[model samples]
Target: MPGGTDSKSGRIGAITTGTREAGRLPVLFLHGVGSDKSVWMPQLAHFGGDRMAIAADYPGYGDSDFVEGATRADYARAMLGLLDRLEVDRVVVCGLSLGGIIALEMALFAPERIAGLVIANSFARHPEGEAIYDRSVAGARDMGMAALAKARAPMLLGKDPPEGLAEEVIEVMSAIPPEAYVLGAEAVWRADLTQHLHRIACPALVLCGSEDAVTPPQLSDELAAALPSARREDIAGAGHLSNAERAEAFNLSVDAFLSDLDEKP
Candidate 1:
């Protein structure tokens, strides 16, 4: 819980329900800015381990409140705290969009706790066409999310967002506090894990929507190229939220990647 308790050791915010039976290390999920754990509701049935599958609401977003003023570092620390409370020693850290930035930071600071890594619809930098983060922050703060939401929905969705899904997409994003969105945007802007990409030593999977404009395929390619053991996978007919927009294909990519790692020498 990012915005839970000011003290990492203390509980905070609205706790999301359900937990896996004890088995292996957990997959501790971190969501992007302007998003909550519910965004990954689609993955619950698919990715959680026998022991764990956890998604944390960023300090200010979702059920987590921003009692600590909300910083990217705070989110990372809260994750470590959650793992401590769960009595889990390690995790497969997965993140998307701004969440990926947090995963990169987790890898950088606490790689010992990470057994694997998944970076989806994310990048080490906002390359040429990936201007969504910057634009959303600026517009949402100055003019409000209405314009940002309208302009971004198409960029984030596939050519055809399956029936009855477009409105839900807009709602998930529009709920962000303009100010918290601004803060997270600033963190993403300031975060540059490019130099440390080679240091990600775990089994890493870098995925993107084939048509993603927010993070772009090139972004994941660069990450794959940089991480010594990383593999790149692209889900066709999807955009920023590949896991949600192209659930089947996206899960297949991740499953295959993880399965391959299990087979390695």
Candidate 2:
């Protein structure tokens, strides 16, 4: 798929397919700190067959232009701005890790604009937030993104990942600019959205990989319990990047959730 830039909205870059159909909300896929829009190829392909499916590159990642000292709010606003440019009134957001946090922020920022949410391998409030941010930034600053990717890629996958999966992860993470990685890490790890979860009343599907040591299933449990209308689903034997590790299962869960949404009058 080709990438297009919305220069008016912080240069948000996105790859989209399919057409907007009546009564069907568009699905927007957001990538994690260590990934770009390409990680959602499987999802875009599957969902695009029936309705509009979009995967966006956050500012400072992939084809999007960089933003100096960007915060989570800034990222959320950029996405909303993109929606405005696209003339989309409402959407269903599917996000993982860093992307999940941004998705929550977007819902809180504009509850009326969001139809539903699919949050995977993420947390409302990380237990060791400061420590994780400090360590990640230090590693990125010291070893650079390439070396950091080589070291962290394995930790992001399950005990037994598919062939070349780790190498694919390393390749993707290595391509991220060190500065962008550091900036994204700070935004993701330092965020605390616990108090605001109640404000997002949209239906939500909270997913976590059974083998995810990064955010862990416990975090998803807490997130589901906190959200007003949310449920939890676990991707068996998968890790932090469950969508990539188990695309078929992830898509099935999301499809079922969207199907339920469509049934609502």
* Candidate 2 regions with alpha-carbon error over 4 angstroms: 1-9, 263-265
Angstrom error of the Cα, residue 32, model 2: value is 0.6
Pairs clashing within candidate 1: 2-59, 3-59
- Root-mean-square deviation of Cα positions for candidate 1 versus the true structure, in angstroms: 3.4
TM-score of each: 0.86, 0.97
Tell me how candidate 2 scores on lDDT: 0.90
Query: Per-residue lDDT for 103-196 in model 2, tens only?
Result: 9999999999999999999999999888989989988899988898998998899998878889989999999988888889988999999999
lDDT of 2 at 113: 95
- Cα shift from native, residue 70, model 1 (Å): 3.3
The regions of model 1 sitting more than 4 angstroms off are: 1-6, 9-23, 48-51, 67-69, 128-134, 260-265
Task: List the global CA lDDT of all models.
Answer: 0.72, 0.90
